[model samples]
Target: MFRNARLSLFLPFLVCVCANGAALAQSLPQPASQNGISYITGGVGEDEVQAFRAAAPGYNLRMTFASKTGSYLSDIDVTITSGAGRSVLSVRTEGPFLFVRLPAGRYQIGAQTRHITETRKIQVPAHGGADLRFYWEDPDRHGVMRVCKSCPDTARP
Candidate 1:
């Protein structure tokens, strides 16, 4: 009787948890196709990120965008080209993750943000997938001069 009572108490909680997880997964962005290439991009929140990670294995090419300091980046313009230089897929990512179903071959990926672009070449295996990460230097940490109003500037020879 004790075991049956415990099982009954746990079942409803399990069901609710499973239902909520399913609903969250369903809320993720749907896969899209362009020029016969299928892809999905989005990972704006924890739930969406988890959903993307769960779906990633089904894709042949998985990409992630971030800064050198490890902050996630979005609104990246992504372009993938075949080894022969033919454009296969081009789209702007809505979040930090982009998953693509591509044929087994060599491809070049270009991700652009804030007018700066980074390129990478990758190979997709015949059976599994490839993961690519693109990291950009944080703008605030580089190329910007900080000035102190109260400190006198020393002239350099």
Candidate 2:
């Protein structure tokens, strides 16, 4: 009887803690699905970056966007196509990080910003994830576009 009373007393506190945790998780950015592919995009702030890092393990593809100078970037239009030429996911990212869960296969990722588009081909392993980075040239302070010297021939506009 005493043990039952102890568990009863602890149950309400456990419930409250679990409820608060669920609420907090709900308030964070949630994954969206398209064509059976699930993805989440956002890393605008430190807390959000941490959240994305914590969730990265569950995703099979992780992408990061930045400028040639290494500053993080956002507002990129992204599309992922399967090796069989089927469109898997297409969305405009609101932040610098994109995490996707994909089957083991080859894929093409296209990212566009400031009227410049770059494409990359990647193979997702069966047991682990693939990480891809897309870099764009930073516009001049006067807002004029400049050539990216270090960009590959394919990435050049």
Candidate 3:
């Protein structure tokens, strides 16, 4: 009975999320020369994956994730959301680096942590080359997710 009551309470929240997702979907832009988003995903050891998303009109983005000496990050997934909150591009990495193509627009790029999720928005120009970045802490200590526009520094962990 308790589980059922909890599920009922959460149902509306799930619906709202779905509704917002639908409202955010927008058409991908196609330029006379090219159409698609460009992305890069990879990190070293524990910080194995790093991702960058740039809008067509945006500047070139450069990303850097802080890590230990030997190990690197892995399994980093980045989704590019339009300034309006629609998911415009999505990329996940299985190997060291993944390169994707995208149209130019304002984008919100999110970096994943075991507990926390970090997000950064970037603009990509029509041709190529934009500088953008995001950073987050490991969940080894906090066990909670924290979001940030820029990389975050914690008291501990």
Highest lDDT, which number? Answer: 1
TM-score of model 2 relative to the true fold? 0.74
What lDDT score goes with residue 39 in model 2?
Answer: 94
TM-score of each: 0.85, 0.74, 0.44
The per-model lDDT (C-alpha) reads: 0.90, 0.87, 0.50
lDDT of candidate 3 at residue 136, scale 0 to 100 = 46
Query: How much does candidate 3 score in TM-score?
Result: 0.44
- Model 3: lDDT to the true structure: 0.50
Model 3 shows how many backbone clashes?
46
**Clash numbers, per candidate:** 0, 0, 46
Query: How would you encode candidate 3's per-residue C-alpha lDDT over 1-157 as one tens digit per residue?
Result: 9999999999999999777554332222222211254444443332222112222223254444433332344566656677888776565544333344555667777866464567776775666666543444443434555577475757355
- Once fitted onto the true fold, the runs of candidate 2 whose alpha carbons sit more than 4 angstroms away are 1-27, 140-157
Give candidate 1's whole-model lDDT: 0.90
Q: Evaluate residue 35 in candidate 2 and report its C-alpha lDDT on the 0 to 100 scale.
A: 90
Q: Tens digits of per-residue lDDT for model 1 on 1-157?
A: 9999999999999999999789777967999999999999999988898889889888989999999989999999999999999999999999999999999999999999988999999998999899999999875555645488676544322
- Report how far residue 31 has shifted in candidate 2, in Å: 0.6
Expressed as tens digits, the lDDT of each residue in 1-157 for candidate 2 is 9999999999999999888666546545889999989999988887677678778899989999999888899999999999999999999998999999999999999999988899999999999899999988764332554488675555335
**Lowest summed lDDT over 10 consecutive residues: which window, candidate 1?**
148-157
